[model samples]
Each structure stands twice: as C-alpha cells, then as structure tokens.
Target: MGWNDMQPLLVQATQETLWMVGLAALATVLLGLPLGLLLALTRRGGLLANAPVNKLVGTVVNVGRSLPFVILIVAIIPFTRWVTGTTLGWQAATVPLAVGAIPFFARLVETAVADVDGGLIEAVQAMGGGAWTVVRKALLPEALPALISALTTTVIALIGYSAMAGTVGGGGLGTLAINYGYMRFETTFMWVIAAELVVLVTLVQLVGEGLARSLDHKRPAAASRWTFRRSVPTQTSAAPEAAETAAQETELTGSALR
Candidate 1:
C-alpha cells in the first residue's frame, strides 16, 4: 500500500492505542491507590494492622501479578463482558487492563507508602491524628515521589499491555503491526508501528521521570532548606527567651533602685 493509503490506518491505530492506555491508567490509579493504602496500613505492625485483611489483599495482589498478561486477558473475558457489556473493542480491553494494572499499581503504592518514615506516623498519632489524617499528612506526602515513579512504571506497563490486547482484536497499533508486518509481510508497515511504539514508550518514560522528579521532596535544595531552617531557632522561641532576659535585667535594676 502507498504512504497515502497507510496514513489513515496508522492514525486510527494510534488513537486506539492512546484510548486503551489512557483509560487504563486512570482506572489503575483510582482502584490501585486505595488498595495500596489498605495493603500498607493493614500489614503486620501497620497502623490498622489486621492480619486477615492484609493476608487476603496480599494474596490477591500476588496471584494477580503472577498471571501472564495474555492469560489474564483471556481469563477475565467473562467478567469483562459482564462489566463492559461486550467481549471486544476498546471498552472491553479496559477491563483486563484495569484488572491487570490494579495489583501492579497497588504493589508499587505499597512500596511507596511503606517507604514513609514510621516516626512521622508516630508523631501524627501523638498529635491525636486519626488514620486518615496520618495518611493524608504523612504517608501520601512522604510517598509522593515514589508514587509518581510507580505511576510512570505503570503507564509504560500499560503500553505493553495495550500491544497484547491486539491479539484479541482490540485493534491498536499492535494489531496493525501484526496484521501488516507479520501476516502480510509488509516490513515497512511493521517498522513504522514498531517505531511508533518505541516513541510512545519513550515519551511515557520521560514524562514519568519528569513528574517523579518534580514530586520528589528529597531533592538537594529542598532537603538543604529544611536542614537550615531546622537548625535555626524560630522567632516564636527566640522572642520568649529575649523577653525573659529583659525581665531579669529589669528586676535587678529595681533592686538597685531600692
């Protein structure tokens, strides 16, 4: 086929890929964030520390993560159809993408949240902060950097999953690549799709890295500023010390006057 003929096909494939990936990322974040928090908080010695719930959530995450993507795509077809009302197309593809991504994202989240300082949580508790407040003030903020990195990893992973979805007629760039490059022996078409996928992956990685860096509170400048500020006494503290010294001096002067 001529370049002119291939342009529209390529465009459609690209859009489909974007749709699959974008929707999957959204779903993964929404579902995975809570699941990850639950995993972190319910584990042994965690704030909420429920053995049974932790075990159950951990088991489910492990089992889901263990399954290969293609198998997962097939395994969840029934549920996908039930939830999405169809067994094929972009929407149907989301079901498996989400199902596959949730556990992966959750594990990442668990790691991120777990990396938060236990001391911070203790401080919050000492201040009478509840679980939600602790999570909001301590865990999430502390873990924001890792969580952003995890999101980047998750998006890249979803791109790979989108390719796999093509096998089931989900019709993305992967499907185009397979159909033209493999079946029809169109090397140019195949290369085009492959290059596109590479570029897409690269872009995702770059954006993810940038976001992770931006969200990271551990950067040298921020850390240095925190250290400097902490080393200095606050005005509130210095003011009281100054007032007490002045009061003592005044008392001495009064005694001398008498």
Candidate 2:
C-alpha cells in the first residue's frame, strides 16, 4: 500500500496499541497493588507478617515473571479464550498482556513498599493504627511515586507484549508492523509503526517521570515544613529561659560591684 493508503491503518493501529496498553496497565495496577502489598506485609516482621503466605506469593510472582512474553501469550491461550471468548484481537491480547504484567507489577510494588521507612510503620503502629491503616496511610502514600514509575514500566512492557501478541493473531501496532511492514516488504510502513511505538513509549515514560518528580518534589517541602513546626516550639521555649538566666547573671554582677 502507498503511504497515503496506509495512513488510516497506521492511525487505527496506534489507537489499538494505546487501548490495549492503557487497559492492561490499569488492570495490572488494580490487581497488582494489593497483591504486592500482601507480599510486603506478609514478609518476616512486616505488619501482617506471615512467612508462609509471603513465600507462596513470592513464588507465584516469580514464576509468572520468569516466563517470556511470547511464551506467556501462548501458555495462557485457554485462559485468554475463557476470559475474552476468543483468543484474538486487541481485547484477547489484553488478557495475556494484563496477566503477564500483574506479577511484574506486583514485584515492583513489593520493592517500592519494602523501601518505605520501617520507622514510619512503627510510628503508625504506635499510634494504634491497624495494618490496613498503616498500609493506606504510610505504605501507599510513601510509595506513590515509585508505584507510578512501576506502572510506567509495566505499560511500556505491555506495549511490547501487545506487539508480540500480533504474531499470535493479537492485533495492534505489531500486527501492522508484521503484516504490512515486514511480511509485505513495506519498509516505510514498518518504520512508521516503529516510530509510532517509539513515540508512544516515550510519551508514557515522560509522563511517568514528570509525575514522580512532582510527587518527590512535594515530599522535601513537606518534611521541611514539619521540621520547622517541630523546631519552633523548642526555639521559643529556650529563648525565655536564656534571657532570664542572662538577666540573673547581670543582676549578680551589679550587686557584687556595689
């Protein structure tokens, strides 16, 4: 097909890729966050620590992460069929994309949550806050930026996975690249799809990084405000005592001189 003829196809394919990646990323986050939190909390000495449960979940996540995307797509064909009622198209493609991404996202969440200050958890507990409260207030809030970053990574990975899904009749930019660009010897079409994918992934990363930076920027300001509030009372309390002591010393000196 000529470039003009291929324009509509390219636009449609871009939309398909975006739709698949966006939905899959959303699903991954919804399912992965709690699962990852469970992993973090169930680990030894965690708020809801249960060693056995942690190990079991860790193992499952690991196994899922270990599979190659293409292999995962093939391996989960039956589940994909069951979920989408057909093992083809962008919708069916999302099943594997989401499935593959959940474990990966969970692991990222685990890492992000694990990095949260243990002291924060302890302080929350000391306040009589329960596990859920700590998780909601401390863990999730503290890990928000990192989780955004993880979602960004998962979305990029899903884009690649969706393209790979094209090989298995999963349609998207990948199908466009393969069917029109690669197989049909249309180099220009292939490059166009490739460029679009690059642009898409780039936009995703930029947005993710921007959000993370914005969140991170707020944290230091908040910490500084808290520190300032905490220190003001100490400084104020000391001023009166210091002034009184100095006055007392002056009085003693004047009396001695007389």
Candidate 3:
C-alpha cells in the first residue's frame, strides 16, 4: 500500500494507542499510589509496621507482576467485560492494562518512597507530625525525583501493554502493523509502525529523565552547599565555649601575677 493509503489507518491506530495509554496511566496512578505508600509504610519497622499485612500485599504485588501480559489479558476477560461491558475495544483494553499496571506501578512507587531518607521521616515525627503528614511533607517531597522516574517507567510499560491489547481488536498501532505488515506482507508499513513506536518510547524516556533531573535535590553541588550551611551554626556555637575557656585562663593568670 502507498503512504497515502496507510495514513488514515495510522491516524486511527495512533488515536487508539493514545486513548488506551492515557486512561491506563490515570488509573494506575490513582490505584497504585496508595498501594505503594502502604507497602512502603507498613513493612517491618516502617511507619505503620505490620508484618502480616506487608507480606500479604507484597505477595499479591509479586503475583501480579509475575503474570505474563497475554495471560493476564485472557485471565481478566470476564472482569473486563463486566467493568467495561465489552471485551473487545480500547476501553476493554484499559481494564487489563490498568489491573496489570497498578501492581507494577505500586511496586515502583514503594521503591521510590523507600528511597526517602529515614532521618527526614524521624524529623517529621519529632515535630509531632502524624503518618499522613510525614508522608506528604517528608517522604513524598524527599523522594520526588525517584517517584517521577518511576512514573515514567509506568507510562512506558503501559504503552507496551497497549500494544498487546491489539490482539483483542483493541486496534492500536500494533493492530495496524499486524494487519498490513504481517498479514499482507507489507514490509514498509511494518517499518513505519516500528519507527513510530521507537519514537514514542524515546520521547517518554526523555521527558521522564528531564522531570527526574528537575526534581532531584541530591545534586552534589547544591547538596554540598546545603550541608555546609547546616553545619556552620554548630561550628560557630562551639567557638563561644572556646573563647570563654581562654578568657577564664587569662583571668586566672592575672590574679596569680597580682
């Protein structure tokens, strides 16, 4: 087929991919954020430490993560149909996409939250802050960079999952590629679709990296300066004790001489 012949199909496929990815991302964030936080905060010695709960949640997350996407899609068909009222469209695709993604995203979020400094959490607690306050003001802020990176990974993974959705007539770029490139043996069409996927993945990575860098407060230059500033007061306070000691010695010597 000519380029013109493929243009409309490409547009439709792109739209379908975007719709699937966007909705899945939104759902993942909503469902995963709390689960991730819970996982991080309920581990042994964590804010809401509970070994049994943590173990259960961890097992479930691991199980979800371990399942193959194809199997997951098939396994969740009935639930997808119930939730979406159809198991064969972009909307239907989102059901499995979101379900599969939530646990994955939650684990990423847990890792990000765990990377937060323990001292920050302790500081918040010392200030009489509650769990939610500590999470909001300390954990999330401190781990913003890691969390942003995690979010990027989640989005990229969702794109891959959306491609798999094509098997069920989800009709994204994957479907277009399969229909023309595989079924019709149109090599050029396949290449075009492949190139688009690469570009999309690249763009997602670049944007995610940019956001991560922007959020990172641990850059050496700024961090070193901040550390120095924090230490200066302690150094200055010690100076007064040294000065007092010297003055007392001088006074004793003068009295002895008199």
Question: Each candidate's lDDT (Cα)?
Answer: 0.80, 0.79, 0.80
Q: How far is 95's C-alpha from truth in model 1 (Å)?
A: 1.0
**Pick by TM-score: 2 or 3, better one:** 3
The predictions' CA RMSDs to the true structure, in order, are 18.6, 18.5, 18.4
lDDT string for model 3 (40-154, tens) is 9998889999999999999998888877877888999999989999988788898888998888889878988987879999999999999999999999888886777677778
Cα lDDT for residue 65, candidate 1: 82
In candidate 2, stretches whose alpha carbon ends up further than 4 angstroms from where it belongs are 218-258
Worst 10 residues of 1 by lDDT: 249-258
Q: What TM-score against the true fold does each predicted structure earn?
A: 0.84, 0.83, 0.84
Positional deviation of 140 in candidate 2, in angstroms? 0.3
In model 3, where do residues sit more than 4 Å from their true spots? 220-258
